[model samples]
Target: MPVLDLLDLPAACPPGTPWLGLDLGENTIGVAASDTSRMIASPLELIRKTKFTQDAERLIKLMNGRNVSALVIGLPMNMDGTEGPRAQSCRAFARNLDRIQPVNVAFWDERLSTSAVERFLIEDLDLSRKRRAGVVDRTAAAWILQGALDRVRDQATWV
Candidate 1:
C-alpha cells in the first residue's frame, strides 16, 4: 500500500487488526500500537536509529507480532502547514517502508507533539528531565496515535 492521508487510512486498515504508530526522530523511532478495536493507543517500544534495513526489519517484526495492518507515522511539519526537511524525511521513510513491507501508511501532522508530551510529563506527571527523556518519544508516539484514532472515530460517527 502507498502512503495515504489520515482520512483514508482507516479504510485501508483491516477490521480487528492493530495499527502501528511511529514517531521517527533522528536518533530513535518511538513506537505505539492501537487496540484491535482501534479506540485506544499505547506506547510500545523505542528503536534506536540504525541503518534503514535494520530499522525496517525491527518494525516489520513488531507489526507481525502485533498483527498490525497499517501504520500511522508522525510527520513533523512546520506550524504554517508546510512540509520541512524533517517532514520530507518522514515521508521518504514511509515510502521506503512500504516498498520493503507494503503495509498501509498514513501521516499525522505532529507539530508540537513532543513539546506537548514534555509539558505533560513536567506538569502532570512531575517526571524529572532524565526520566522524561527516556520515555518522551514513545509517549509522544501514543499522543500522535491517539489524535489520529480520535479523528478516525469521529469521522466514523458522521459517516
Candidate 2:
C-alpha cells in the first residue's frame, strides 16, 4: 500500500495487529514495535546498515514474524518544520518498502527525537556514553513510535 496518513492507520491495519516503528540512520536502522493494543511501543532491534534490498528484506521478515500491520517510519524533519535530505531519504525508503511489500506505511515528524532520547538516556537513565551508543537508536525508535501512538490514541478519543 502507498503511504497513508497517520490518522488513517487504525482503519487501514487489521485490528489487534502490531505496528512496527523505524528510525533510519546513516549506519543503522532502529526498530520498535507497538503492542497489539497499539497502546505501548517498545524498542525491538537495531539493524546495521546494509544494501537497501537486504535492509528491506530484514524488515519484511521481522514484520512477518510479528504479524505487523503497518510501519510508522520516522521522517527527520528540520527544527524549522521543513523537509531536509534526511526526510527525503526516509520518504524514498518508505516508498521502496511499500512497493516491496503490501503493508501500510506512514511517516511521523521526528524532529528532536534522537536528542530527546539521548537526553533521557543520560539524565534520566544515567547511562554512560558508551552504553548509550549501543541503545540510542532503538530507543529513539521507541520515542518516535510512542509519539505516533499517542497521537493516534488522542485522535481516536475525540471521535
Candidate 3:
C-alpha cells in the first residue's frame, strides 16, 4: 500500500487490531504498540540500527508477533512546520516499510516529541541524564503514539 497520513490510518484498519508506532533515529528504532482497543500506547523495545534489510526484517518480525495492522511513524518535522531532510528520511522509511510489509504505513508530526519526553523523564520521573538517554527514544515513541491514539479515541467518542 502507499504511504498514508496518520489521521487516515484508523479508518484503514480492522476494528480490533492495534497500530505500531516507530521513532526511527539514526542509531536506533524506538518502538511502541497500542492496545488491541487502540486506546493506549506503550513502549515495546528499541532496535539498534543495522543495515536497512536487517532493520526491516526485525521490524517485520515484531509486527507479526504483535499482530500490528498498521504503522505510525514519527516524522521529524521542523519546528517551523516545514519538511526537512529528517522528514524526508522518515517518509522514505515509511515508503520502504510499506513496500516490504503488507501493513499500511503513515506518519505523524513529531516536532518536540523528544523534548517533551525528556522533560517528563527529568521533571516527573527524576531520571538521570544517562538513563534518560537510554530510554528517551522509546518514550518519545510512546508520546507520539499516545497523541495519535488520543485522536482516534476522540473520533470514536463522537460516533
Question: Per the 3 Å backbone cut-off, how many clashing residue pairs does candidate 1 have?
Answer: 0
TM-score of each: 0.97, 0.97, 0.94
| Lowest lDDT block of 10, candidate 2 | 94-103
The lDDT for every candidate, in the order shown, is: 0.93, 0.94, 0.87
Tens digit of per-residue lDDT, candidate 3, span 1-159 = 657776678778888898889998999999999999988999988989989889999999999998889888899998889999989998788777767886888778899999999999999999999889889998889999999888767877898
lDDT string, candidate 1, 51-131, tens digits: 999999999999999999899999999999999999999988988887889998889999999999999999999999999
RMSD of 2: 0.8
| Candidate numbers sorted by lDDT from highest down | 2, 1, 3
How many Å off is the CA of 29 in candidate 3?
0.7
- Residue runs of model 3 more than 4 Å from their true location after superposition: none
**Backbone clash count for every predicted candidate, in the order shown:** 0, 0, 0
- Per-residue lDDT of 54 in model 2: 96
